[model samples]
Target chain A: MTISQAGSYPSSKGIKISTVDTKEVLCGTALIKRGFAHMQKHGVIMDVTNVEQAQIAEDAGAVAVMVLDKLPYDVRHAGGVARTASVKVIQSILDSVSIPIMAKCRIGHSSEASILEEIGVDMVDESEVLSPADENRHIWKWNYTTPFVNGAKNLGEALRRIEEGAAMIRTKGEPGTGDVSQAVAHIRMVNNEIKKIKGIYDNNDDQELIRISREIQSSFEIVKETGKLGRLPVVNFAAGGISTPADAALLMKLGCDGIFVGSGIFKAEDPLERAKAVVIATTYFDDPKTVLEAQKMIDEKKSMLGLDTKNLDLKMQERGPTI
Target chain B: MNNELLIGVLGLQGDIEENIKATTNALKEMNLKGKVLSVRYPEEIMKIDGLIIPGGESTVMGLLIAIKNGLLDAITKILQEGLPVMGTCAGMIVLAKKSYDKIVGNKRQLLLGVLDIEVERNSFGRQYDSFESKLNISGIGNDYKGIFIRAPTVISVGPQVEILSKFDEKIVAVKQENIIGTSFHPELSGDYRMHRLFIQLVTNWKDANKGHQNF
Candidate 1:
């Protein structure tokens, strides 16, 4: 671990810092937040609606399960107000599963996040899939003890979310669509932007760095940090619209730290088999043979009917603040 | 000890890279020669001088091991043959001889049962309840920040095990011969003292086992 002076900035947001011996140990700081996200690396986090589905996900070797009221597909189909999962259901799933249980809250909904935190949900996704509570501004996540994960389509959005204290990042591909193209594009875009910043940092072009930071609407420190790290400050997982084991593997191969299946698993013909296969594929993403074995475990005909991202009336990826 | 040692971090899931980086840094700080590898397949367990089971979901780690044929057996056999191993948090639970949920009955999960201890899962509550504390660990000096994230606690231990540290009168760390288990993650703590100690254990074990056939 490269122990950077993460919370060294003089901000009133209360970045807690504690020193142990000569070593500067960060507690309730960036390390704790990023460390929590790091635990989910190279694994699969499945989305499930209820206790039974959560149990099946646990049984399928998922690192964690995301608990939500409705599958993203159903949420889109219903065309009504989408909200957080029920307290009763979340508690029951928490009791039933040994792995971490993550729940989604509407973008900028701090009260829902507080309730989830009180209920002891492991992590909160300030997800765009849910109707945005306040589209103009996101919650100041640094105020809360619980870590929040936000979605981004490109580098500026990712840094903005990270600046707001999101411990993790996921590409906000069109949710409810089984398509992986938008996710692929989003990750590539983020990677290219990172590469551009890294070039500026490497050249020691202070003026250019400032210009780029302004363009991204993030502080010079965070943009510089992202350049130095050559990646997002937190774990970046590929989410939204992943349905198959191959899709999971592709994301892993494309530099995603992990995989998230939203509407993909439950909507599949064989949820258990598909869930297990995706997990396997993700763990052994670098190995073609194992990926092939995982591919054989699921039937292509049983996959969800994917939506075309080009024709979506509701684009979750575009919901959050652009700058 | 050999000129260059090879250490493996069990890479089925969870914080594998963090452990690898920490181990590499520990090796460099001690001015020792070693390489850290992420060991995913069961057969790779035999090639490492030592092993580290990182923090993740114990249920997922155990289940993944059980899914792959001979993985559990492979790890258990090598650990018994005295390959120094350190398990942190979820890793600690996986190494325990027995495990139970704090709120409910015994958990039906795959544990290697190498460490002669009983661990209570989620004894520190959920992620929100997770915290960091300074500990006076034996031999490593004091004020080492111990980060517990949805961590577990050792409920009981056998005679062979030595308690290393504790918090609120509960066991948080243990050492038994070649095995070391901590309910908190040393890799995430930013203090490499614990990793250094584990590396020292690995060096000692390698020196003692010289040309043993199992190694």
Candidate 2:
């Protein structure tokens, strides 16, 4: 049925019409960019390589999928320059799935980010998992309309990325290892620092706050805002080595707004079951019984053979700029 | 506890915190005694006077809720029994009886199927085409910021649904009695008028259903 025929109101007859001015319809504003990331909060974002993988992620209830040329584990094994996923594959995945599709660009690679944005990818990740394109600088994210999710090891990198217009932040845990230790450490470190800043702000110690701001290399205002909010200004997710339902739940319990699973699901013996299990664990992070049920959904023997962060030759988390 | 309103933002996925914050602020501004929670469990879903399904991927939300065993049924039953609910953006897609993508075509996901509307997902195109506008939300008033982010537009509604707001003559907001659905995200906006209106609906629903409280 048509609007006027089915509904009670007859096509704008009794509707309170404004002057019918063409209100400026603005896109890619900061609110729009940041707001897009907010919609992904409390959800699992999985890494998918092809159309089939993308569809699997969608079937498993991933809020979004991040497309990559190779999963991080395979990237580590390949040990070469990993660029964005092929245009054909990305396009196919985008066309195939109704959920938001994200693609990761090399650190400091503007052209790659621009290309992905041009293809209408929902979000871009200026990720360190891919080989670094620049040694000294990360891409200035504010230059583009496409929202970016940057990884951070501590509070400094997070606020710096936010200052550079990164709409979302995730901990740069040791990628490809499948070990949750580094991810746990990074989020805990970020949370501990936020606690410290909140304490300084609560004490009305502007001097200490400014000193801490300089130390972290974040803007004083953003630092103060972080302190006031007692969390990152934007959504913070845990990424890199998340591999199990318990791993996902632990990060959520540690205050990650959501999760980004890379090599976690696909590398497991039962990708579908593991993916579904992780989504459930993340959704009910605070509930132990549900988490336990999720944990049992997958066999421990089927999990990816994890590497220790200390033994890795190429540490991806150390790729981005220290300052 | 009896007089206080307990509102919930469906926590399966997407913008749960934003809705919680918006509802909390609306409660404070209106000086109402209420508690807003991020709810996921069926038991939790049964205890609320009102619920908000936040913006995210509607496919993911529907799948997650359905997998939770009886969660979708609980939400549908509550809405049918006069529990006030507001769905925004992808949330609006979940509330609709039918939804299809403008490009990829028909989807096969679980839906609450409570709101009597057919929604066209990504009707304004992809994320790159997402935009913001000033709309006259009939009940909430004018110049309301309508942030449409890869949003849906209601193609048509049944006679029971009341069209509340429109942009470019497309249905962006509709109310089917205790249930309200919007194509734009009110939680993302700085304005709390829409949320205030939702809380008002919740308050009135609670008053009318007095001894019939599900909790």
Candidate 3:
């Protein structure tokens, strides 16, 4: 019943918490101004344990890093069961980082997740929907204090996560398969479905109810309307399969909130350079102007080994919760 | 006696004073009596023709009402006689027949039991994870702002109940004959039209019951 932390304090750094009554919602650009607008900085979600590789992302502009089950030098695994790792790994990352840290888990591994929350990890993911080795396991329960970011194989999967308390959504491509199309298709589907229901669902509020319902459906359309699928996520990005800065630019064009390059950077020859390009691509996913400004870096070829699907531990395959 | 109608606001807990201030201020603005009385006794139930159960943690409110002398029995007796009641957030919770998660906490918590709905506490996750969104409500002309803080969602609306509104298809509000329930709080805002609508229900009921009382 007790949360570890709450309350706000003013700092000399000029940070302030303006309390907005989210109870009753208004329509139009106000929602855009308040809810979905500020997350435009395409977040970087790094899922590595080695501090060196982790720093590559941090330096290259990843908004946050995800500490994982296998250390980079372990050479024994790529990912693990709903987060089957030592608690100390997560604890160390919490100690080492100032930015947010993310961790992965299987559908029912909520107990482990609770431990991660205790470590103060900022976000959690129910991964494996992208991993080619396992069947999909739907995760509706996430027992942790950190906000969740789930993967969507398609639109229905995405909406279900939103209904189940997930704060962020991303498209899933088969990890280790070196494919970006699945991620692209998934993003398109989510955008279209939300637009259709936006107005119909918007109008049906009951007056006799105590408080007025004051929120509008989020504009998933912003992601769909954008032309390219190889996107740089700026707002709430969790779409993976960004192999290069070009791929990232496509996602930004597709309106992603952030980027998750599980294998894209680590598997690449120049993890640092690729990471740098991705950071630039997401920072300006839109404004042909900004992406154009970041174009020089976007064109550079940084080859990644891609996940060697055949060599991956077959036993490690498992389905994760939806996005 | 006052030309304007009188309505009781259940001052149990959660967003109690907020609802009172909003409802009272609304009535003042409308030039209506709208006496927003804080009723904790069965005797108090008879004073106001209508009631507003503002949003709150239901379990706590139920426990408190259970200890308030004969208050629980009084509420049940009044509801059995068919009084117009509107419950928001936790208030809507107390109106239901049963709640979820094996109903932990103290045994004193009981409902007035007017509606047949089954409620699940924290159905949409815990309070910090609870969200506010605009939802379509019946009778209200526009979208009512739904503030779902530690809200109780109606898992199953019983036979006599009418489903009111939903978010992502989850039932967030419901109504039965004289009792209305919502998962969100309306009194938290400046909007008085919904409060006005409930008052009209009470006024019309009082007007209809006057001749019957004399008989």
User: Which candidate number has the best lDDT?
Assistant: 2
Model 1, residue A94: C-alpha shift (Å): 1.8
The better candidate by DockQ, 1 or 3, is: 1
Please write out the lDDT profile of model 3 over residues B39-69, one tens digit for every residue: 6556676566777876644544564566456
Question: For model 1, what is the error of residue B61's alpha carbon versus the real structure, in angstroms, after optimal superposition?
Answer: 1.2
Highest-TM-score candidate = 1
TM-score of chain A of 1: 0.94
Instruction: Decide which is better by lDDT, 2 or 3.
Output: 2
Per-model clash counts, in order, read: 0, 0, 43
lDDT of 3 at B143: 59
Q: Judged by TM-score relative to the true structure, which candidate is superior, 1 or 2? A: 1
What DockQ, on C-alphas, does every prediction get?
A: 0.46, 0.47, 0.03
lDDT of 1 at B21: 88
* Residue A209 displacement (Å), model 2: 1.3
Tens-place lDDT digits, model 1, residues A33-118: 66778888888999889989998998888999998999888988888889999999999998888788899999889899989988
Score every model by TM-score: 0.95, 0.94, 0.44
Model 2 misplaced regions, further than 4 Å = A1-21, B211-215
What ranges in model 1 sit over 4 Å off? A1-27, B211-215
